[model samples]
Target: MKIIGFKINNYKSIGSTENFLSVEPKVTALIGKNESGKSNILEAVGKLSFDRPLSSSYLNNKNRGASGEVSIIVHLEYYQSELNEFEISQANTSISFTDNRVVKIEGGLSELLNDDELLMEAIQCVLEMNIRSVWGNDSNRIKSVQDYLNGLKAITSQVYINHSARLGNLKNWITNDYTSKEDLIEKLEIIDNCLTKYYSLLPSVYYREQYPQLEASYKYDDIKNIFKEPNHIFNRFLLAAGITEQEIVEAFEDPIDGNRKTVRNRIARKIQKNIEAEFNEFYNQEKIEFQVEFESRVFKIYILTDDKAMNLSERSNGLRWYISIFVDVLSREYKNKSLVYLLDEPGVYLHVNAQKQLLELFLRLAERDNQVIYTTHSPYMIDSRDITNVRAIEKVEGGNTKVFKSAYNQNLSNDSKMETLSPLVQAIGADLKFNIGPSTSNNNLITEGITDYMYMNAMINYLAIDSALNIIPSAGVSNINRIVSILIGWGCEFKILLDYDKAGYNEYDVLVNKLDETLEDKILFVSCNEEVVKEKMWSNPQTIESLISKDDFKKLSTPYDGSSSSKKLAAKEFHDKVVNKEIQLENETVSNFQTLFEAIEIQKHNIAIVRD
Candidate 1:
């Protein structure tokens, strides 16, 4: 299943936001600067699904009257079969089902939308039924809401990793309510007694105390000794109900061995041991491992550290930042559940290479159908290729927060692809090329043909003039308007250089006001200096008696005297003469137009002239 869409509101820095998650990408990166709502997106997922704390402190939103709430809605899609049963083979003619019977259930995977009731059922079903066999049999597959929930359980909680603070709360809860080891052995004995109560003949079999004392495995004596009236078990109940530890101790006498003040230390150890055992079982199914080393004692997967290995508490902020998170992630993965990971500025102290490696690991997790959302200020963690995914998060003027994509949104131009890795200027250059803008700092020198563009560049280099002004040649007069609109939009400096006759003036008239309005300060109108222009090259003179004479203009209008290749050669010859000082070119800027050809002489290449 894949999440298709998401919507959220009033969550931390996010006033409201909506998005569509990309599909099965090798990688999807969220790009945004610090506090740009990227973390808010992650938090919304955590808040809705994982039962995370929604306090002012957690979200830095103390001013919302401490009553703010976050909401998230997600859309998902997946493949489903047409049968309602766990497996319904199409080949079974007798058990035929229509298409309406098949559906692909989608789990609302966002943590923001804590909809897990159906998911629980799905889990129960998967546990009880032979899912793999059913799936393999081309069996009747039903798209039950429970199936979606089950799918979510597999995906969302696989590695629901969070930083230390969140882990701290989860550990406290799990230790207090579920994995408390003392409770495990006590509960086991309770089960035994309950069994004995049901079957009179099995009373001997249910007698735990009658068994021999054993040190290496679970102990029947330890179980009986734990719940001996008014012991830690009772105190644990009182503690859970909000009684203070001191009050619980005062009210209860030690039922075990009849000691009063010696509280149950073994219970804590027992709980820890039970958790390890549960972890082992979970890992056996999930193919993961969880281990840890504590400073106080050797426990499950113990790692004993020497005094030399331990650092002073005052100087261990770096270690503190990572150690707990590392443990939490491994533990969760070991439990064999898919999880949406939340990381708040992870690697605040790690080396750059380590951060990069961490990001690589995050990618691997994502590839395996887990979601990892994190916030960080380190540039090293930014996947340059995923920069397009960055959303600029900001607080608006009306005290509302907003998230917006950067001007560098991927759709802007192909050049935007380079923005992630290339230098700013080089990326800008590519952008301009793709956008086809004319003149950045000064008025653009627009020309009538590619020949003119080549000549202009050659001229600039020949004159050895350093200028930021850019020149782009319109493929033809028809494209001048388009080039003008873009140049105007960019508000760049520019100049128009059309041929000196009717077509030139017409294009200038149509574009001059456009440039004036959009790029007023930067635009300049520079016509070809009539006197210095090549009289022999004029294509269509407006008057009967013009520079090269009416007879020459009439001849120019006639069909070309040779093949398209020969015409191209003639055009090249004219350009070379203009650059060589053999043919006197026009004005000061026209002087520049001639040099582009001189810079890199257009090599001998075939040119196709339009047949008249």
Candidate 2:
């Protein structure tokens, strides 16, 4: 199951005007500046969880003043097969076998019985038939019905079942004036069980924030009691370790009962193995070993690092935070269940790289039948390649928050919102600028931006020309001179490739005048006939994209409706075709690129000869 999208109304800064935010199935990043209601969006989505509901305090202050009711709707997509399977399982199981199903049925029946006498009669007759079929004799019918009804009543008072009604509050219908006929009531219980199971198969939503610190001095009794709650797999494992009541009593009396000690050690080893496995999935560091010890009449957890033992509390804040969260999540018995995770500012305390690891962890978790929506101002957390996954939350003039599909969309002109998008922009910009990886190669080629880098790098690799030469993109035409200067200062042998535009020529002139004459040999431009450019071009400024034939240009830009940005994007597509060997280059285009490549190689050879 997945959450496709959601809408929020009268929730804090999220007014009714711009409340809808479409969520991606895998990872949806909520990008916004502080106070832009990013957290509010997460909170509103969280209220859709069965465990969480819209509260009075959650109402927007502005809406409260206007006496408007707060509303939130979450759109979900679920697999029909899973729902069918759940229904089948519920149908096969009895109410006494599953307390959760019983409670939901009771609650559902109670609400349903408020009206609809005809429906009630129909349900009663079905129940009577079911009871008669299951318990053949009338003598056994009363005891059986009383036992099933008692079980339902007991669970209804104690447990809060998370299933919603399937057939218009049928559980409420059953609860309302349940027939005294034992057989009929038993049959009704079966129907309620099926309804509850059907509801459980639906996609569930869960809200997670930073975990709180657990008490340090918790003894075996405390751990044992808490572990029995069935919250997570770790707790379940501990409970399954068979820590009997007699064992607890023996531990208090002797503090070293052999059987009790063996169980504790076995549980500790199991937990350590699981934690290490989870940790290594996201982090590659020293192999972490855990030791569970009973000291000072308390259960203590410690980590073994470099053959030295350290208490979990003694670890760094980041490590502790990771462990706490991992353990907390591992403790959840429903981890494998399909869930929509709404994470608000996750990994705020971790370093940038660790936060990146956390992002990887989110992806890994999402791959396991889950969708994760998180809010982050950090660029490391954003997947720049898939900008479509980003939703920009911006504060409007009236203090209402609006969400934009993409931060880079030209439609969003708000200066503050743009500022909020800075991290993402900078991240992508940095990637474009430093196309070369760390290496000792002296041959470096600097281009304008990603498109230029992509085109040239593809050509270089296709031609197998000087594989050692690093291709670096300056991010923009204007940054070329400054980047060249830095490369020169680093004593690197480099060549600059710029477009054939007026600005490109101007920057070339400025750099030649600014740098020493000795370095002037390194500067170059894309060679295209000025007469041909003037005759064939539709625009004044000629870029490297102008090198393509007019027919090919038309083919590329036709899909984009001839817009400049679209043309630029189309140019990228054209480059991809060339790189993939899909397009046969014209003789003139091949000659032009060959001339450029030769010029770059000649410059490198000349520089090397001069140094030798």
Candidate 3:
């Protein structure tokens, strides 16, 4: 089985996240500031255990007056399947066995939502009726993942007709009377037996923050630390690779050439090859030749790079971290079953490019039957190209943590948006080129064309209004969708500013039709993240040109050019006058533009562009 997602709620800084934080099949990154609850999230997922209960500290939320039960759960797929792609194909089985038609959840309290009910019922039905499975302890079996994925697919389908109405408050049902959060705890134990076969097969999660450095020369006595927990990660790594005290002792007693068929040399060669391969592939820092020695119980490890040879301790922390994680992660694979690696600020010590290299290493580690979930503040660590795996975490001062699956969360308060979505500026900004040079700020405003852009700029400049939006002029109203798509791709924080009139409303409806809720909601709100912009300013149908008074527009217009050309010339003239302080804009014109600007400010205009 594979972990497709994890959810954390009612923990230290986190509240009930609306949905499961989906993980890309390979690797995932939890990104935010230092105290934004990113590290807490990693720790929570790592703490999932069958035998242990949460500490008393976990239940304490006196700070935020949090009274809800903690409900953190992970969704495991028997086999990874895309939405609507999994088919319920049962395996043909003839073995006579128990007729029990349950998948463990029969032991827990019910009244589950329709989706959960169908999911469990479907799994149980398949487990009872049609499974050619490998039965383990307590009759827990390894049935085909097809049945499991089909159950999830039922709820995750693209076709809207397949969805059920929000029947009831899921929170109420889940916590109706779950005494001391037993129901939530039961979920972990229940899945341990029936639903999560592959999850159960793995050993306990190995979480780490303090990575031990590689030792150049180990004393004979240091071998005793091999089986130790977290503190001796480098030793644990070596142990996982089947290197032993016995082999080291023999090497000391009987030294031989590396090409010989000796146990020590073979071990040395393997370690040398793996260290070099792992380092070279992931770390973009100076390339080095490994000095892997098994000549004695005092085994030596060294690296020669940049024409200088140095022991592991003499290297930079970043280099040590890179090599250490390489050995540490690979060692986990030697345990026979896959394990989740909860890494904390993995590349914090690395520079920009080196941090990016660490991300690549993590991707390699996750693809090998293991899952890697890391937390970081650096944008270099996040892959915006395919961001399904990225979860932006935020915590307002003295507020519960809010985890957003998408950067475009309308629910985010303005401060939260600036805090959580800021990393995306450099991450996505560098990836795409724009027709216009963007203002240093990211609160972009997409306009229909140059005339609207010029007029808005002029108005803002003249009024001396501290407008936060850096207006971006698109080719026309019809071309807005293409720019919107690009902004969405970059995960940019922006708004669409169009003429609030009939033609604009029709195009808005067209946008509403073209993109689904997930895509459209990020960029297609009516006005400034649903803040009903400019409603009282004018009741008549109007264009951006209407923002200026009729007499002022007539004063600026020319008889030489056509209508469109005339508007462009008029807009330029007004902009020059505003910039040079040559003309004082009328009170009505100033009020009209300020009304629109205030609406944009209040909501940050994710969508408001339309034309008449």
Candidate 4:
């Protein structure tokens, strides 16, 4: 079974999620700021029991159900061969359920309820539970089922109204002729155990802030026995590190009749060499060597450094944490076709460079058919080589988690796409290039977004205005700070143009007094809102498009008849015409743009005086 997606509802701060929150088959990087419910998301996914977690505290405080219900849905894909094998196993196993306990099931049941074959297959699971009850408490096999069916038919409204069909089906399944007990059990087992058996194939989820500690040394006698216990801390770590029980056992054996200790030493050396080879593939701070030695019947680990061997305790906390995650990550790699890793703010103790190395490890694991969904505020952890797989969780109204993924919507406003990229705080959050345009310009005009770039660039060329300002498209008004940071980092001088609306007016204060007071004169507000907007019959003009007349706006609207179209695409089309000088415009539109350019020159002169 493979996890394809999950949906959550009424879980803590999460009121409800997307209809289906699709998960990437390989690594998924979920980015958001602190207290944005990023960690809560990972916690929900990591604690996904083979069934599901039940915690009253997990339910939302408000707008929750009377039962304080929390709903979680995990969608899985099962191979035909695996499903066949699971059905075969369930039929041969014996089970009993005569305690009269109510049975409950949840998640992804609508499909089964809709399909007749699937509904019958699911009904068999309930049927098999009743038939298996005959073996409970050594009761008479036939009478136990008969009494159960009789009781199911009598004295119970639930069984009669709900299960009269179950009684009718019982008559068809249980024949009058006596049969061997094994034969009856075999007949009952043919019903299918898709739900239970699917759970068996699922990989167990393990979530932790600190990895289980590995002992420095262990007695060879105890090590052999302890290795048999899969859940033993030491055994788990060793297994995750690719150590095998058979290898450990063989290490202590004298197969050729040589000294036992000498034979053990030879095999131990090979194991140590393999550990070093695997560990070093992702860590490059230094060339590390592992030394596993057996002396006086005790096995001890030593870390080799600079030609000196040191005890494992002598290593840095960062290195120790890395080793713990490395082994645990690779533990299931060889056994399962795919794995889900929910790492919550991984590499907290590691420095920037060390965190970079840790991210490399995650990428390497993802390549081996594992999916890593980790939460992080750090940009270094995000693999931005592709932005489509990234998802952002932001706290919205009523403190609920809202995912900003409308960036992919074809007709969404530029603001929607910008909101999705906000959580990717740095230049690397989206498919943005930080070092390209800014480096080529000495003095720059950073607009609120690409909308300004497309329209303004076309107008400047159309008016034949001589200008040296390099117009750059920012992420959006909300991301002005990040744009400022990028420009400051590149040692570039720039001015920002803000719209005359709420977000823009408030951003000036946020940028100057709050972010950096030095930018007081570097910020400029739109001049068209007063002169052009009030004079025109158009309801309101907040952008450069407002400077264009209605006839021109309709001209760029493309098809001249479509009610909805991508504004960005339309802007590009207008820009192409203006650049080719194949289009003519109204005198008012030309005058409006000229007035805005003249105002910019005056603003630049005013800022220059203050600087001097």
| lDDT value, residue 547 of candidate 3 | 69
Best by lDDT: 2
Candidate 3 local lDDT, 1-612, one digit each (tens): 356566665667777645256665567777766687877777776765422344455444322546566555555543323112333332211111111121121101111212354345543443342222212222222232333434333422211111112111111233333343443334323332332332233234678867776666776566656534444765655654566656655565554555233866667676666566666766656778776664445767778898788877888887777777777776776655567788997877777777777777777777666788888766677764334355777776556676765454445566666556555534544234421224345577777665676677776666655555666555458767776776766767777775665556555656667754453443432233343234432354456777677656656645213365466557657776676576766766776776777666644353223211
Better of 1 and 3 by lDDT: 3
Q: Quick one: ranking by TM-score, best first?
A: 2, 4, 3, 1
Residue 61 lDDT in model 3?
A: 31
Please give, for residues 51-164, the per-residue lDDT of candidate 1 as tens digits. Answer: 222343434442252244544344433212212222322221110011111212122222311333343443344334343332223223323323532533443333222223
Q: Please provide TM-scores, in order, for all candidate models, with all chains considered together.
A: 0.33, 0.60, 0.52, 0.55
Return whichever of 1 and 3 wins on TM-score: 3
lDDT of each: 0.37, 0.57, 0.56, 0.57
Clashes of each: 43, 20, 6, 0
Q: How far is candidate 1 from the true structure (C-alpha RMSD, Å)?
A: 23.5
Encode model 2's per-residue lDDT on 1-612: one tens digit a residue: 455667666767777766788777678898888998898888776755433334445543334322355666555554445546423221111111111122122322233232334434544565444434334435554464545444334332222243233222333333333454454445455546553543454356667754565333466656667655654433533433334445444545554577667766665666657666677677655567767777766767687888999887887787767666656554543444677778888777776667777877777767776788999887777754334467788887777788775454444545784577755654443233432221335566777765566566545544545446666665467777776666666566677776766667666667876766665577666663323243233346656665555555555534334475664456455655655566655555554556666666634332211111
Error of 1 at 259 (Å): 27
User: Which consecutive 10 residues in model 3 have the weakest lDDT in total?
Assistant: 93-102
C-alpha RMSD of each candidate structure in angstroms: 23.5, 11.4, 18.6, 13.1
Off by over 4 Å in 3: 16-20, 50-64, 80-204, 227-231, 239-242, 253-263, 294-297, 430-612
Model 3 local distance difference test score: 0.56
